[model samples]
Target chain A: MLLCLLGSYFFYGWWDWRFMTLILFSTILDYSIGLKLTDTEAPKTRKRLLLSSVIINLGILGFFKYFNFFIDSFREMLLTVGVEASMSELNIILPVGISFYTFQSMSYTIDLYRKKIPVERDFLRFATYISFFPQLVAGPIVRAKDFLPQLQRTITFDWNRFNSGLSLVLWGFFKKVVVADSLAPFVDLCFEAPETFSSIHLMLGVIFYSFQIYCDFSGYSDIAIGLARILGFDFPENFKTPYFSKNFSEFWTRWHITLSSWLRDYLYISLGGNRHGTFFTYRNLMITMLLGGLWHGASWVFVFWGFLHGMYLVVQRLIEQPFRSLMTKLRVPTILSAAMSIAVVYFFTCFAWIFFRAPDFEIASTVITRIASLEGFHPSTIISKFMALKGILLIGVLLIIELTNFRIHYIPLLVRKPAFRLAAFALILWAIAFFGTFGANAFIYFQF
Target chain B: MKQQIFSRVGWAVLFVFVVFIGDRAGGWLCQQIVKGSGFRYSRMYTDKAKCDILLLGNSRGLGFYQPTIEEITGKKTFNLSYNGMTMDLGKVLVEDYLERYPAPERLVIDVTMCDRSSPEILASFVPYIADSDRLKGLIRDTSYNVAAATSVSHLYRYNSEIFQRALYYSNGKSDNEWLLDRAMSTSTLKHTENQKYRIDARFIKELKATIEYAESKGTEVELVMTPYYPPFAKVVRGLDIFHEDIERGTGRRVRDYSYAIEDPSCFGDFQHLNKKGSKLYMQQLKADGVL
Candidate 1:
C-alpha cells in the first residue's frame, strides 16, 4: 500500500514530494502506535492506548483540514474588536485519503481494544490491509475486520473470476470514457462559468453533472473492485443502483454503501443510536450525518450537503405517519409511490449536489438564484444542439438498462450469451474509443 | 472441476470469435455504404497518390482552405483536414498522404496555437498509426457522429449543425459528384481570420517535418496564418515572440496573413471569413505567387 501510494503520488503528480515524506512519517507513527496498543494484555492500558491513538489521529485531521477554516472565522470576529489583526492564509494541502484511512485504522485499534477483532500479527499484512491499492486513493473504506482476513489468505487465480473481472473493468472504462467524460465539457462549461449561460443551460448542466459524477465515481469503484477481483481479493461493493433508490434512506443504503454502513455501525450506533429515545435518536442521526458530510471535506458546502441528507432522514422520521396516511389516501400504486419517492429524493440530492459541485457558497447561491429566475426560455437552440431526439433516445436506453438489470450480478449473466454479449462489448468499446472527449480528468471523488 | 474449467475457456474463446466477426462485418457494411454513395469528398482522396495538392490542419484548416488550389494550379487537390485535429495530426496526415500519394506539387497548412500546444491532441495520433484497426473501427462505427447528435450544448454553442448538415447532404455520392461539388463550392469560398496565437515546441517540430517532407518530394510548402477579427488579429500580431520561436524551432519562414487585410465586412464571425472575403483572400494569395 505504501509503495502504491508513493507510485500514484509520482504517477498522478497529485502532491509535492514533501507531502509524500509526511505520509511516510505518519504511517510509521501509526504502525508503532498500533504495535504498542496491542502489546499489552491489560484492558485499562489497552483502552488508554487506543483512546490516545484516536485522539492523535483526529487531532491531526482536525488541525490540517479545519485549522484554516476556523482561523478565518475567528479573524472575522476579531475585526469587530479594537485590535485589528490578520493571520497569513495557510495554503495547506490536505493529504489524500487521510479521512478514509484514519477512520479505517482507528476502527482497527478500537475493535481490537474492545475485543471485537484480534490484532494482526504480521505488520506488513496489516499495513497492506489499511492501504490496499485498489481502494487506497478513493475507497470503500475497508474495515480491518472485513479486509484483514482476506489479506491473510494466499491468493489463487480463477478463470471465471478473471473473465468476470475483465468484463467489469471494461464496463467501468466505457462508463467513464463514454458517458462521464463526454458529459464533462457541457457540465464544466455551465458550472465553471455560469454567468454566460441561461437558466435552462444551468439546469441542464447540473443534470449532466449529476450523471457525470455518478458514472465517474461509481465507474472508478467498479474498476477498483474488478482489479482486486482479478488479484484474487473481494472488496465490498460500494454502489448499488443508487439512482434507482426509492427514498433518502434507501439511497444511503445503495450509494457509497461501504461509507454509509461504516458510519451506521461505528458512529451512528455508538452515539446512542435509537436506543436512547426518539428525540436522542434524531439527534444522533443528525450529528452522525453532518459529521459524515464534514468528513468529505473541511468546507461549509459539505456541511450543507450532509445537513440536507440529515434533514431528509429527520423529516422522514417526523412525518412517517402522515406520509403513510397520505400515500394510503391517494390510492397510489406501489410502483407509482416508489417512483414519486425516488423522484423526490433525486430532486433533493441534485439540489445538494449544487453545493458539492460549486467552488464556494457564493457561487452556489448564484446558481440557485439564477435557476430561480428562469430568465431566458430559449429551447430551440438547446434542442437543436443537443440533438433532442437522440439525447432522449440515449436517456431512454440508460433508464431501461437501469430499471431492468440494476444489480452487478446481472451484468455477468447478461454477458454469458456469447454472441450478443460480445457484440454489446464491441459497440461500447467503439463508442468510448471514438466518441470519448479525451481530457485530463480524474474521478470526482479523488479529492475526497 | 476440469469440465467446468474447459467450459469457461470454451465460452471465452467463442466470445472473442463472435466479436471479431461482428466488427469485420460492421466495417465492410460501412465501407460499402460509403463507396456506393454520392458523397463528394469521400472518395476524392481515398487514394492519396493521385492527388496533386493536399491541405492539412484542424477544423480551421478544414473550414478555411479551398481545394480549388488544384483547379487553379491545374492539379488534383484534396483537403485532408479533420475536425479538432492537432499539430501531431498535422504531422501524421502529412506522412500518411505522402506514403499513399506521390509528393504533391504544393502543401498548404493552417496553423493554430491551442491545437498545437495540447498534449491530448498529440497523444491521439499515436494509436492511429500504431493500432490501425483500432482507429479504422472507430471511424467506421461513426460513434463521434452519434455523440455529436446527443450533445446539446456542443451543438448550440459550436455550430456543429452546419457541419452535420453538410455531411448528411454529401451522403451517397459518386466520385464525379464529389468533384463537381468541390468545383461549385470553390467559387464561393471565403477567408477567415486566425485568433489566439499560442505556440508549443511540438507544433513547431511537426511543422518543420512537414516542410522537410515537402522539400524532399520537390514540393513547395506555404505556412498560412488565416485572417481573424481586428481584436483577435491584434492578439495574433502581438505573438511576435511565439512567431520567432516557431521560426527558430522549424528553421523555416512562415507567412503571416493574419493582418494582410482587415475589412470587417469580409468576416462572417470574429475569426471566420465570408464568401466574398475568401475569394478576395485567394486573389491576394495568387498575386503573391503563393497559390
Candidate 2:
C-alpha cells in the first residue's frame, strides 16, 4: 500500500523523489519498531510503547496534514482578540494515505494491547501485512488476527477463487473506467464554475459526483480484493451496494463497510458505546462520527459531512419507536417503506457529498447557495450542456445494476450458461476497451 | 474439488469463445448497413485523395480547426482529428495517413498541453489504433487508382451493420450526422483562450519527434501555441523553468500567440477562441507566412 501510495504520488506529479525516500525510511523504521515492540510480553511496558507509537504516528500526521489547519484556526482566534499575531505558514506536503495506513498500523498495536491477537513474531510478514500493497492505500482495515493468519499460512492457488477474483477485477475496471470516468466530464463541466450553472445542473452535478465517488472508491476496493484473492489472500468486502441502503444506519453498514465497522468496533464501542445510557450514547455517536469525518481530511467540509451523518443517526435513534409505530399504523408496504427510507437517506447523503466533493467551505457554500436559488431555469441550456438525456440514461443503468443485482457475489450466477457468460464478459471487455476512460485518473480516496 | 475446478474452467473458456464469435458477428452486421448507404467510408466529409492539408489533434483540435481552412486556402483538406489524441499517438495517425495518402503539403498539429503532456494520452488513443488489415483496407479504399467497384466491396465489409446501429444508439448520432450538424450550427467555433505557452521538457521531446518526422518528409512543422484566455496563458508563460528546458532541449523557435490578440471579445471562454478571434488569428498566421 505504501508503494502504491508512493507510486501514485510520483505518477500524479504531486511529490518529489526526496519525499518518497523520506516515506520509505519512515516506513522501515516504523515497521522495525512495530516488530520489535510486538516481540515482548510486557503488558505495562507495551501500553507505554503503544501510546508512544500512537503519538509518533499521529505526530507525523498532525505536522504534515493538520498543522496548517490548526495554525489558521489559531490565527483566526487571535484576530478576534485585537492583538494581531500571525505566523509564517509552512507549506507541508501531506503524504498520501497517511490517515488511512496510520489508523491501520495503530489497529495492530491496539489489537495487541487488547490481547485480541498475538504480536507477529515475523517482521517481514508483519510489515507486509501492514503495507500489503492492495488494501494499503484505501483499506478493508484488515484485522491483525484475520490478515496475519492468512499471511502465516502457505498460499495455495484455488481456481474458483481465481475466477471470482478475475471477475471482480474486471467488474471494478468496468465501473471505474467506463461509468465513473465517463461521468467525470459532465461532473467537471457543471462544477467547474458552479455560479454559471442552474440549480438543475448543480443538482445533476452533485448526483453525478455521488455516483462517481461510489464507483471510484468501491471500484478501488473491488480491485484490491480481487488482487488479494489472486494472491491467495482474502480481504474483506469494503462496500455492499451502498446506494441501495434503506437508511443512514443501513448506509453506514453498507458504504465503506470496513471503515464504518472499524469506527464502530474501535472508536464507538470504545467510547462507552450505547452502554452508558441515551445521553452518553448520543454523545458517543457524535464524537465517533465527528472524528470519523475528520479522519477523511483536515477540512471542515469533512467535519460537516461526518456531522450530518451523525445527526441522521441521532435523529433516527430518537424517532425509532414513534416512527416504527407510525409505519405499522400506516400499513406501509415493506418494500415501499424501505424505498422511502433509502430515498431519504440517499438525498441527505447526496447533499453532504457536495461538502465532500468541493475544494473548501467557500465552494461548498456557493453550491448550497446556488441550489437554494431558483434562478437559471433554462431547460434547454441544461439539456444541451449537461447531456441531460445521456446522464439520466447512465444513472438509470447504474441503478438497475445496483438494485436488480444488489449483491455483487451473485454476478457469477448471471452467467449460468458458459456461452452466454463468455459473451457478456466479452461485451463488457470490448465496451471498456473501446469506450472506457482508462486514463490516469486517480481513485478519489487516494487523497485521504 | 479438482473435478469441480476443471468443470468451471471448461465453462469459462467456452464462454469466452462465444463472446468473441458474437462480437465478430455484431461487427460484421454493422459493416453491411453502413456500406449500403451512399456514404464514402474514407471521406465521409471530403475527397481523401484531393486533400492537400490535414488538421490533427484531440477534441480541441476538432472544435478549433475549421475544415473551411481547405476552402480558404483553395486546397482540399481534412480534419482527421479524433476527440482525445496525444502527440505520441498522433505519430501513429500521421504514419497511418502517410501510408495511404500522398503526404499533405502542410499539417497543423495543435500542440495543446492537455494533448502532449498528459500521461493519460495513451488511454485516449487506444481505440484509434486500428488493426493492420483494417488499416490496409482503409488505405486501399482511399487511394485514387482504386476502381470504384474494387473499393466498394472493401468498404462494405468494413462498415458493419450491427456495429453501426450500436454506435448510433450509444452515441445518439452518427459521426457524419454530427459533422453535418456542426457545419450548420450558428454557434461560433471557439479556439482556446488564456492560451498558456509553456514549452516544458516533455513538450520539447514531443516537438522534436514531430518536427524531425515532418522535416524528413519535406513537410514544414510550425509549432503554434493556440491562444488561451489571459490568466491561463499567464500561468503557462510564468513557467520559466519549463520554457527554459524546452528552449534548451529543442533549439526551435517557440511562437507565443497567446497574447498576440488582446481583445477579450475574441474569446468565448478562458481557453477557447471565439469565431471572430479564430479569423483574426488565422489572418495573423497568414500575414506571418506561417501557413
Among the numbered candidates, top TM-score falls to 1
Model 2 residue A395 distance off true place after TM-score fit, in angstroms: 3.4
What tens-digit string does per-residue lDDT give for candidate 2 at A107-181? 777776677877676656666675676776677678777888987677777866776687778778877887788
| RMSD of each predicted structure | 8.8, 9.1
Q: What DockQ number belongs to candidate 2?
A: 0.09
The Cα RMSD in angstroms, rounded to one decimal, for candidate 1 relative to the true structure is 8.8
TM-score (C-alpha) between model 1 and the true structure: 0.69
User: Over the stretch A1-448, how does candidate 1's per-residue lDDT look in tens digits?
Assistant: 4454445546334545565554454456567766777788887887788778778888878877888987876787798786567787788877777777777777887777677887677766776776666777788778888888987677778865776677778777866776777677677766665654557767777777777888888888888888888877788888888878877888999888888988998889889899988899989989988998988887889988899899989988888689879999999898888888888888888998898888788778767877777755455324124333223434465567777786555756877665656666766655554445555788887777
For B257-291, candidate 1 gives per-residue lDDT tens digits of 76765776665544555555666666776677767
> Candidate 2: what is its chain A TM-score?
0.90
If scored against the real structure, what TM-score would every candidate get? 0.69, 0.68
* Lowest lDDT 10-residue stretch of candidate 2 chain A: A378-387
Instruction: Please list the residue runs of candidate 1 whose C-alpha ends up more than 4 Å from where it truly belongs after superposition.
Output: A1-47, A63-86, A89-94, A276-279, A376-379, A383-397, A407-409, A414-439, B1-16, B27-291
Candidate 2 ranges beyond 4 A from true positions:
A1-46, A80-86, A383-391, A407-409, A413-421, B1-291
- The TM-scores that each candidate's chain B achieves against the reference are 0.65, 0.61
